[model samples]
Target: MYCYFDGQFMPISEVSISPMDHGFLYGVGFFETFRTYEGYIIDKELHEERMNRALKDVRISLDYSFDEVERWCRRLNEEEGGRDGYFRWNVYAGEEGIGMAADRYDHPHHLLLRKPLQRTERGTSKRGFILEHRRNTPESSMRHKSFNFLNNVKARQEVTSLATEEGILLNADGFVTEGVTSNIFWVKDCVVYTPSRETGLLEGTLRHRLLQLARQHYEVEVGCYEPSDLLNADEVWVTNAVQELVPLHEIDHVSFLGKEGPVYSDLHEQYTEYVKERVSEQC
Candidate 1:
């Protein structure tokens, strides 16, 4: 695989970062991950909007624009025979010594990583289980998809140790927060439910777009919810850019509609068409 570091493209194995880099020293970095479709990046604006807000929160400045990102994507994909690929756009505060600097970061470092796209087919299902670790509060006002991922990493370890595909995390107040790496959603009595950002979740781009699509046909609710509310849902699913939307067969052996649920089927179809439409536009 090839990764663009700073200003050059090279093999991922050859790329390196200084130990004193603030991103590695004090976790002062943020990133976004998405997949390209026929060389076109979907939801680029949403991803950048989120990344910019996170960078601003920590006074870390990034100068990369969408045009630059697209060019990088095109080049990186061409490296793999022009195939669509998964990409990680990471920017961090350049070397700033050991201590936390009070001034804003002017010399930022960046890396554009490319990997094979991996996602399950629509209608496939995965199971979820609640994790013993409570969800950690955001370091700032909102959760930034940053390098500070120890909490999620540990939860992910537990999920693997427990042999579950999706691990659900709860706030200290016992409200359903979100999946370790994805936003959570459920359907009940034809109304769609998901935890609000107040629960300290990294509101995903797909979650936001799904809400818009669902609102056109079903009532939508966003708030702090309990596991019981989820276990009792008519349908359950999790969303991320990589996975798009995945049906939950069951959580804790309590089965819902899973992939066969009417809501999941309808919304999944809509989402599939949405992506195809974007690909068509690119063509």
Candidate 2:
């Protein structure tokens, strides 16, 4: 595999960073992950927009433009023979001597990495378990894809089964916030519902798209919801950039009626068509 470091493309094995870098020492960095289809990034603009907001929030100076980033992605994809894959763009404090102060870093370094994505079987449903750990609210409010991911890592470790797709994380208030890596949504009585951003969940790009798409055909509600709400839901779904949309068949002891419920099926079909259209536009 190859990755873009600084301003050059090199083998991932040869890439190295200073051990004293602020990103490594203090976890001061921001990143965005999205999928590419046939060399084109899905929702490139949306990702860029979110990245800009996150960088500003963390007081990281923006030195690169979205167009330049896109060009590099296209170049790397071509170099890799144009395979569909997942990509991560990371911007971190470049200062070698970091002492928990951002003022020391004059400029940040950006790295782009890609890895081939294995396609999953069609109609596959994800099984999740409500984790014992609750999301720490105040810090989670940032909602940026920062380098501090130990919380998510620990939550993911609780998923003992390989078949479990994700671990559902609740907020301190005992409200379902989101999955360890994706946003959570459920349907009850033909209404689609998901946790609001106030619940300390990241506003995922796919989650926003799905909400917009579903709103056209169903009443989409965003608010704090408890575990019982999900357990009694007629259908449950999780959304992220890579997995896209995954219907939930079971959560812990509560098993849903069907593998893919009617609401999920319709929205998934529409989402697929939407993706095709976007990819074609890039072509």
Candidate 3:
């Protein structure tokens, strides 16, 4: 496999970082995972903008432009047989450091990794497990895609079933936030609801796009919600860059009406069409 490390393209085996790197030492790094359809990246500009904002927030000094990053992604995708796959862009403090300080670093390291995407049925449904882990406080939340993923990792470990799709996490105050890997959403009485950004959930790219697409068809509400809200929902779904949207058959013991509910079917169909249009424009 080939990856982009720093400014060069090389075999993945050749890429390495210092043991003292602050990202590894203090979790001072952020990453973005995106999907490419036949080498066409979806929402590249939005992903770039989000990453830039994350870098600035953490004081990571990386000067690469989005155009340059996209070019590298295209090249790597072409080299990897031009199939649908996942791309992860990781930026971290490169300087050797031991403390929580960011002022010591002058430049950051950039790593781009790629892997072929596993095919899944578009109508696939998932069963969720309500995890005991609570998301970080709003003030301490790394809402961006950061390397500090121990919370998510721990939550995922609680899911013992292979058939289970994801673990739903709540905030410290017992309000539903998101899944370990995706943003959570539900439809109740024809209204779409998701946890607000104040819940300390990462405002995912696909989540944002879906909200925009949904608002044209239904009333979209974002606020603090409890598990009972999802348990009684007519339809439940999760969204991310790769999964796009997955319907939920049940959450813990609560069974939904069906996997492909009416609203979900409509939104999923529209999202699929939207993806096709975006990919065609890139082509």
Best by lDDT: 1
Runs in model 2 lying further than 4 Å from the true structure: 102-104, 161-163
What is candidate 1's lDDT per residue for 176-261, written digit by digit as tens?
99998899999999999999999988989898889988888889999989889999998999998877888889999999888899
Please write out the lDDT profile of model 3 over residues 1-283, one tens digit for every residue: 9999988999999988987888899888889998877677678788888998888776777888766777788898788676667889999887666667736466789999989887887868888878898988643445777888888888888887534577899989899999988998899999999999988898899998999999999999999998888898999989898888888888887987555698888988899999899888877
- Which candidate achieves the best TM-score against the true structure? 1
Every model's TM-score: 0.96, 0.94, 0.94
What tens digits encode model 2's per-residue C-alpha lDDT throughout 1-283?
8889889999889888887778999888878888777767777788888888777776777678766777788888887787767789998877768467735456788899988776886568878889999887645346877888887888888877534467999988999998888998899999999999888888899998998999999999999988999899998888888888888888987887445599988988999999899989878
| Decoy 2 TM-score against native | 0.94
Instruction: Enumerate clash totals for all models, in the order shown.
Output: 0, 0, 0
Show model 3 residue runs off by greater than 4 Å: 102-104, 138-142, 161-163
